[model samples]
Target: MLRIPAVIAVLGLSALTLAACASSPSSAASTSCERTDSDASVLDFAQASGDFGKPAVTLKAPVYVDSTTYTDTEVGTGRQITSDAQDVVFSIAIANGATGQSLVQAAPPVQPLSSWNSSYQGLVTAMMCATEGTRVVAAIPASELSAAGAQDLGVTDDQSIAVTIDITKVYLAAADGTPQYNDRRGMPSVVLAPGGRPGVIVPDAAAPTELAVEVLKKGDGETIGQGDTARVQYTGVNWSTRKVTDSTWENGASVAVAPGSKLAFAPQLVGATVGSQLLVVVPAGASGAGGDAATVYVVDVLGIDDPAATN
Candidate 1:
């Protein structure tokens, strides 16, 4: 598995988050299933422990796959995916259906559902209408694998691809990026569009003279600790101008933050619970940029990046 930074540096904000690959098990035995077709028997499927405490898939060996097929190894009881879902996050194990050799096994990563590419039809089908915690095994004909995908697997156009996907989370596309509710008065308001992008609405009154922090949404996951890497989506606005300085929402990705970054609001993020949203106000001269005007930030803490689990 390869660990890629969840976030990248961008204008106005110090950094942005991106997706990364995680590791998986090498092999496992397949479960008993009645083969519907001769070609289907060529591939055997099993579920096993993956890297970083995540679920992994094991294939016995590859066989000639003449057509695309899928099986629901486990059905989830969490949120049911709707057609309106904008993005899906899941882990996957991909291998050559003909040789049964592992191509790539990745931990959960966010994927857009609207991509209509023919090569991605297998993934799209596996995610559409699926619920959180669902485990799916899909076998795709070699013709269906995209050129890039085939190349990545080091297979020719004649080889089929088998993939197992574990659905972990799904997010509805934000309609206008506006928050549905607000409780903090005398503070700049925040609105979120689809994809968790935030828009700051500064109040007519003068910016607060001291640091102000508010929790827009409280998460129930793990608590963030100092020096721990955090995966988050956020937006920054200049108080006086009410203009967006930087935002991960615009990039359609979340970012991972390391400890001691120059971000003025990073300290406030520590000790915050996962899945919580924070709104912080940095008074003039407090933003560390020595500016005369203040800055407001809207942050959504997605999760704590596990340093040991990522790679």
Candidate 2:
């Protein structure tokens, strides 16, 4: 739902192809599970040093490129980026390749590559397959830059830009755990796509009279405690029409929710473990649900994020 240029229009990156993209991305790309290997030599004109998150970049001004390219300078053993919608926490540095001038630097929020891809597809490719603690360098050609963004940055399409990124954390792409048994009668059913995206099928039955929950998948990770922020991918539908009402899949981003969150199922999820898939039923008269209609939610608890640690 969040696009690139739309964000830039807010922050003023007239030419930083991704200036607008920096706003937010509800986005992902191809289905290939293979790692995106790169040729590190392509970025010889640009170099980076100093600490991981705080990087100092030196570039040969007036750089030029005909295409976008990237390479990993350091790799971590943590989980890899499985899909475009996978959440990641990282810091980035942006610079003008042609003038060797630095632009903005930031440690952004817990978002998916899908969000960045919506603005600059090149950025997704640069971070693809990268694991936590991995450091990457990407060279983006002006032609690949957003026309409006580059124009605002005062960078000509013929000029290039340099970027250095440090990925600190990565979240699960889906609920990777053992399947759980379900014996609840008259409950909605959930089906998962190959990438672990879920689809719901609500039975033509009466909506529950109270808050109801069932675990469709169980994980071996830590149990969610009070105040823990659960990052999840979920889809919600109205029981009456069975038409979709809200979905992270459509947005290509996962959200961080608290226990008993009204935005989610409004039920306490204290004991739920990470990597668990929850089937939640919110009755029509439930508190704070606005009583539009009964709603069914299939939520994939991807992971738990420390609200303080995350941006």
Candidate 3:
């Protein structure tokens, strides 16, 4: 946890962090984020400057807020976080609004927007419209904090906390692309949930003798390069029993894997664009099942992860 409220009084400022290791998917996002002149003027009370993740701040005066308020100081050119199911890599620096004393500030942690909202409700609206590389400031009134949180931070009922949130990375909530047409004649059919999770329905007919590929949705993003690690959501079902054998959706997180032929469908996915959804059929041994049954996989190419990028 970063020095954010989740552990502020106990662990101190350096303890707040948004580690982007493993996390979950999205909920509907509000596009109606408001930025008022008054709020913007209030946010300006705290001047922040430094490297992106960890900000340096020197408050001009002790500030107070009647309600939650926020505004962006810098707008990033990267992907926008439009859904709660989406997870993000972010950092923070918070201080007691009435005392102008630092309380929390840390960098580089990852979690879903829903999780962040649960920890600091006031930050949610600001985050909804945030993009990778964004820097935003928010003021949370004491009323916004849980009674326990206010007590832990030693803030009076009328006091508040001001924080700077740096959004470094943004992960997609689901596959976003144009629908495709494929001859799924006797192949397993695929269906999608509201959040873009996929379900595979194995046909009651014989599995294909050779490898099979079907394009469920054609993405408009970058083409996945061979040997590149890709972020994805997938489900594997046994054609024989029509039972699911594996799924990333169950774990509530997307995983990054390098594309190659060792797993049968991995290589076939290399040329697929980010955001594309595919259905592939792998027979028994080829699927690494070592059984008589074949496996059908439905995968969503969420995005491509550059290994060199920071967490």
Candidate 4:
């Protein structure tokens, strides 16, 4: 969630060799179930050039997009981790001989860089605590599909991905002595104190809730303009009864809150200032709640990724 204007995306565009390898029958046969155990030798051989240290910790069966699994190593080191509530974003590279490396799939902290671009911030939390050579794999489900972590996963509805992370180095201070790469830097924080509320948040602190929102992918040199999409996540609950009426956070559910949907609003919704909480009151009759009254939505703008900006 930290906004690092200086964060650079190095063009590490190697041809997608592994994708090509996966399509080869010979390659497939060579790495099948019969070779699962021996495969580690080959995998290790490919990964040998890299001195990725032992995992500080490992997480098995970490779930990603809907049933997708990261049932392998999800390791990290003290250097790979920070004591911040927000996740840490590491400089990742492929292990020496490994064919491909990916970011684990999950919300914020767990998501790999491949799935987490500037516009999206998947789940955020404490990650692996391993040594320098630690290697981890995580599953990334598209936003529409991570049933429990929809908002944090920040994907377009239903896009699934897998990622592996190998921390190359960790930094403690900036040139000015400030911390440099944790995920929470420069991002907004949730205010749970008296009379304070964020514009958008998990509908239920305990349950999953997804709200449809537009992201500001681009801005005209001036300000937010037409054609710019505003990114947001939301949830709805009955105002009077406080019962959840509907949600976009559920897996396989629609991810758009367009004009005809239960939550309707103007097309000019994008470009709204970040952190401006929105309250949408849906009348009871509008949703056939019988005499149950209406529902309300509280929204908060987490971050904005201007699509038109030159990276």
Candidate 5:
């Protein structure tokens, strides 16, 4: 996958590129400030240098799509690529460089997007179509982004952006290049108690302590035996505050944990058993909370077929 530092790399290059353009006396303008027709050499350099531009979205998994127009967004530290819009949803964790003595570490996995209006679809769609290791640019009009997304991106009306996507790796169980599980949408809404999370607790008799779950997606018929790898989509929040400090919502991705690690998922979880729900309290630091405290998780098993995969 494109390394996280790639974002900084692209920004750095952008500065240099701007300086270079500003110094050169081109036909009409001095700076390559606006998106212009890319010549063969510029396109070739983008392909070789792994410079996607802006902030590129690197695909950890192969993205499948019918037809979508995407552009190069940005590059990672290793010069990885990223892309722009499409309606694909999947979650991923991004760790900043210099954490844990590593420049770029694998991030948490996320859930996949299936609905038409899923918040993450546009970004995913743009990344899915990009060639592996090559950065493609997408020019998205400001109106296409959500209000919060637009504001966060500093977007303006009639303004277009350059979204770079680098294909670091594409994982698919079959030759057709599609995920084993299909995306889901419009699930039955579950109301949460005043504590905030999803699903209400029954205070009456037979109040169950165990979690009740609904299976949404099935893995590739592989069994999640001991020592196997698993990716799960989860959300964690303070029981008292109900404020979600961490979530895979933006990417629809999951976290890969070992079955025996402090943050491991039970290895025995597999097959139709893949989507089975397990209710467990988030143990302090495990949920990004430093001390011993209670945290709730609503997890969905996305992949359980690979035992050696890094999330």
Candidate 6:
């Protein structure tokens, strides 16, 4: 069975280095700016019209300070970010603190919050605990930017980084991989909630005599092989009661799994394709947990993280 902890480590490591901001700074620094408490008035932000994912951002020059600070110009009424691994989608505009000149504007303007490296203290601090639909302005300390990071933004080591982030949506990280589709019958039917959470309706007949696996949706990405890690969203229903006992969707996060791990669903996921949705039925006595009652699971493969390549 695949363990959730192992999967989290793998997926977290793979996504840790993704950067949402553009690679190159927009302008040269004219002077050094001092860091101060977060003051939204000091930085004027003009968001683009149309889709929230592709908002155009305009902000006034901000004064950089020693400490990283942020303010929520608009608070979101949606879900709150509770974990580092929760995928945060937002549009960001980065600028030089000293000159208030634009630095990097993410072209599509939407990316996962975890895409940013943890070394970026300011970015992380600004985003933590923020809810979806919130608009934030953060001032990053110059010390927070590494020499390489400063170079990428075409700023001197002494300059701070200022940014405006428009929170769009937050989603759990999905698992990945790909394979041909397979068709099967007599499996439990599935209905999805508005948020993509699945509702599994088990048949009224007796439980299957053996483990039954069905691929409801096949992905077109990488393949999950032995030792490869996968991130997934899933819900488990006890056959006898037809009640959901466990769910990543309810918890608002995805789980990682590797083949041969302790996770009951690991073996089934080993050969599944990324982006595939699976319905698995484990017979009561066949289940490893002291021959517990049968359980039904609806699994969505979101992404794959190869341990060999990541290590």
Using lDDT as the measure, the top candidate is 2
3 or 4: which has the higher TM-score?
Answer: 3
lDDT, residue 99, model 5:
19
lDDT of 5 by residue, 167-203 (tens): 4433221111112332323112234222122442322
- TM-score, structure 5 vs. true: 0.34
Which segments of model 4 are wrong by more than 4 Å?
1-93, 97-224, 247-262, 265-268, 285-292, 305-311
Model 1, span 161-262: residue lDDT tens: 677778776543332222336565689877654335567899998888889998777776677788797776667888887787877555545566654657
**lDDT string, candidate 3, 46-124, tens digits:** 7776788877555778878888777788988888877776766777777888888887776543445655454456666
| Residue 253, candidate 5: alpha-carbon lDDT | 32
Residue 103's C-alpha lDDT in candidate 4?
25
Q: Pick the candidate with the highest TM-score.
A: 2
**What is the per-residue lDDT of model 6 for residues 201-277, given as tens digits with 9 covering 90 to 100?**
88887777789888877877567887787767788898888888887665544556777656567789888777688
The candidate, 1 or 2, that scores higher on TM-score is 2
> TM-score of each candidate?
0.64, 0.81, 0.79, 0.30, 0.34, 0.49
Candidate 2 stretches greater than 4 Å from native: 1-32, 60-62, 264-266, 308-311
* Candidate 2, residue 229: how far the Cα is off, in Å: 1.3
- Pick by lDDT: 2 or 3, better one: 2
Per-residue error (Å), model 1, residue 157: 4.1
- Candidate 5 overall Cα lDDT vs. reference? 0.34
What is the model-wide C-alpha lDDT for candidate 1?
0.59
lDDT of 3 at 105: 76
How much lDDT does candidate 2 score? Answer: 0.71
**Candidate 5, run of 10 with poorest lDDT:** 23-32
lDDT of 4 by residue, 130-237 (tens): 333345443434542334333332333545433344544332110111112324222222222221222333233222122233321222222223554433334456
Worst 10 residues of 1 by lDDT: 20-29
**lDDT over C-alpha atoms for residue 214 of model 4:** 31
